[model samples]
Target chain A: MSMDFGFDMITEDEYQRQRALYEPLTEAVRRLIYASLHTDVGADAAAEARTKIEAVTALLETEQRASVPLVHENTGRPLAWANPAVGLRNAIAPPMVIHHEDDGSCWSEFTLSGAYEGPPGWVHGGICALVLDHLLGEAASEGLTQPKFTGTISLRYLRGTPLGPLRAEAFVERTEGVKTFARGYLKDADGATVEAEGVFIRPAWARDAG
Target chain B: MSMDFGFDMITEDEYQRQRALYEPLTEAVRRLIYASLHTDVGADAAAEARTKIEAVTALLETEQRASVPLVHENTGRPLAWANPAVGLRNAIAPPMVIHHEDDGSCWSEFTLSGAYEGPPGWVHGGICALVLDHLLGEAASEGLTQPKFTGTISLRYLRGTPLGPLRAEAFVERTEGVKTFARGYLKDADGATVEAEGVFIRPAWARDAG
Candidate 1:
């Protein structure tokens, strides 16, 4: 999760293209990260990683902080769209690609990898809730003109979600002033694995601005 | 979260020593990882990381899979004791160093960095629940002579948890048959930020084996 930071200065199309171009490298980095965890290698490898940090920091300093594009220029969305857990660009995202339909409902399809596992072959339960809560909140925001923040969420793990392809669907159940109620469930090939209900609030920024 | 893998074959003292020795390197790697995400460097930087993977993988292959210690051998705890979210060795864990007290309660102290941020200056709400759930489950398991898994967790975000030093505490509320009830909250310098309640189940492995 990230803030809009209101730093978007590029065209949305350009941002998307850059995100696409940069994805594979990011993924390679993530895989290597997990590999680093298991290796019994000594300080030399870790030192190399640390050494690269200074050079990278110098490159970043070249870009004026305020001028850097923080969000997608077209969508006003933050760079979190690259987050591994739910990032669209990241193959690692339980990739929860949400589609908001004309009928006031939303659904997504994605897969989980070994990285997200909790129990031997199962997706972490917290990750299940993470995807569900994000989907439900997005479902709630589909009708609104502004962003909504998750206020509370309740999750019931009916069964362990396996580490592979899965689907989820959510819809707004009701609305009372600032609160939007939503419910959803996750399913693997076998059947529904988890369910969630959430209340999302139109935060002060959205409420006051919109 | 990871499986115990039953691969722990080392003495508890050996495990602790290795954990202590390797912790700083793991932390440096983690910080570099988050830094990598934001760096605008070209292929050279990413290539350097890729090159390191092969050497690391070779070192890991040297150890026979059956002999590798995957967790704290004495406790049979998965190596995730170093996981970024709750790991003591990881700088990102919120560290959540839990202390199980004589009165049947547990508490932890930790901090959140920019890597864990969401909603601007606050820690991600899902992460807040992740820590609370883990803590509550651990608290529930304190009196039991067996392991437990999280059954259900309910969280309410009363306020955004600031991205800095924070504290969390949990205690078993009650127990019935295989279920243990626990509750806890997260606090920053100002006050409580999030509160949670959870039910943890002692699975058949813990029930039958222990």
Candidate 2:
């Protein structure tokens, strides 16, 4: 079933508690994922693991499945688990901490872990593109207004983004009707590593979807 | 430990089988990940799931943790489960089936599922970039010679890549010394949705690493 993600019905206090309850579960799942990457035991050992997994799966199945929402209702809250880029609940996510500004802009800071490595001692370029798309999209809507979709994004890689702490910033350049132009860049301690610009649009149907 | 991704040591046959065995495991994990996204039960229900998870984690701990390889060793086998673009072992992967041609070019076909959706009816722009980056990188190397790192990639979104089966192609345009220039585009049933050009380089250090 389709569900609305606009946080109009959720309160700040309720959102905080709801997020708090699931943090540990997502963290555990993330650990399991990274652990699995390194584990491929003997057939006997794997059989044992499978048995354990089956039990967990059975228990999860007993409960009613909550329809997964791709976008959070209250976009302002650092609903870390829901987001694919910075969501802590997701193991694949870099889980950057994002901050929104009043001037239709946003910034995020995070350390790219070994899990995100692509090249030798460098973060994956595709991952960088994912982060920028999310950053610019958030800036376009400030994660508070009608959702804006990424119409187009162009990126330039100045250098390899080293696998460590990095900062990224996005600012809206101009808005022509429903299309908002935004530019963003990522920087490691040394300086800028990647720069991007994109067109984000609030389609006519976005309001109807919410 | 630093490992070489050069596939020189692997045979085509072994590559094929290794991928086959792991495909199911990745598919199971993918299901688990999506399943987890939909399950946020009460504390009691979650505790049961956690207990079962702990049991599995304990069993896995008995063995030495495998060093996760970002890139597979046998790069040319079209190992559907090892690649981030087509690797079935990783749920985050798009699992494209790629066919490499003799003329130093490659093509991949896959569908953008609900998991990869960004806009209402389109694939994520970053996902397109990710696929293009991989497509072009594969074209640059063709899984044969020296490793080529993504030096720079520029993308222009012609239109939204509809969420369904799509094809992407990449071919080397020209090479100047270590620099290999490549171009790629993604297409749905209708026509091209995104186009990209990138420079892949056989870095001097890449030789040393391999």
Candidate 3:
């Protein structure tokens, strides 16, 4: 049984082209989602808008891929264009962009809009879990040079994360052979709203490849 | 301080009317997201589509709400229109419709598409977390009558959940005071792909109200 997670390898130039192409489209779609939620348009106008959206869908579907391709730069960083956490093309993602520190930690600062609400005015707890999981995974992967899958993750919600600008950071707490234990938090201006700890494991194939 | 989670109260008739209006819009936007991921249209066409989408957004925005309203039936079931898990108006949700069994368990059957992919073709681990969290929360709430917030939830990924038709279910294992312990799984055709356990806490306000 092969555990080869097929990734599309592309040059940096090609990665840039696709990113440029899809990022804005994802943004447009994101705005479309937000508008759909808050819109108070009359039924006739709403119907008209839906028709226009349907037309766009048809145009885009004219040239469709069987699946979203996960692209990796020849240099090794992953550009998973369809990833729900940080995918450049996935509108569902808050599209967190992580920054790797010299100290082997990762952090991201992003904003959540109305589309992610769970409670009336707060960011959804699951969405928080999604962001933290991705951050911890990035930390566990050690800059995406070594891929790791999340084995288990636990979160404690100390306070509600308000729907606005927020910060999340994760660091490798330790590594025991094939597994890496990492910890991180989601924060607002006051302090940590949610704290998380996760165990990420390197698959046998990845370990063997390494 | 009052912990009143301000939920808009509406009649069942109003709920039905809003559901009729937004459900199809959400479905359309969901298809738009799927199309965005799979689309391989020419640059010119993509740009043109963006223009049209922007126009639709503007039209929708002509009448907008200050925030996404969380509505509840005057009879008490939450109709969180903006919830990322089961919101009728949220395109980001797989829009899971949970079925509560007589024995206090909840299950949802839905399909995830390219938008939810985390690793190549498989469903993202964080997405699994999101789904499980919502499912377990539903169970803890006991059919949205007794509201509880997720305090801590843990997940163990036994295998990758594929981005296709899938099933998820959760049930309350026990409850001690204000805390409910629930367990659930995400499954593909074969068997359980991910298993989860969660502790959901009924807020002091909810407790007081009860």
lDDT of 2 by residue, B62-163 (tens): 664433443345553333233445555555676777788888789988876645655545676777888898888878877534567787787777777887
TM-score per candidate:
0.81, 0.82, 0.94
TM-score for candidate 2, residues paired by index: 0.82
Off by over 4 Å in 2: A1-8, A61-82, A204-210, B1-8, B11-21, B64-83, B162-164, B206-210
Q: List, residue by residue over A47-164, the lDDT tens digit for candidate 3.
A: 8988899999999999987563455656577676777888778889888988999999999999999899887777888999999988999999986667788999999999788989
TM-score of chain B of 1: 0.78
Any runs in candidate 1 off by more than 4 Å, and if so which? A1-5, A42-79, A82-84, A87-96, A143-145, B1-9, B42-79, B82-84, B88-95, B143-145, B204-210
User: Model 1 over residues B1-210: C-alpha lDDT tens digits?
Assistant: 344545445677776666654565456545554554455555564455445534443443343122232555555455554343455443334455677788889888887665555455666666777677777867887722346767888889897788888899999899999999999999987878888888888876567665
Candidate 1 fraction of reference contacts recovered: 0.20
Q: After superposition, how far is residue A208 of candidate 1 from its true place, in Å?
A: 4.1
Interface RMSD of each: 4.6, 3.2, 1.6
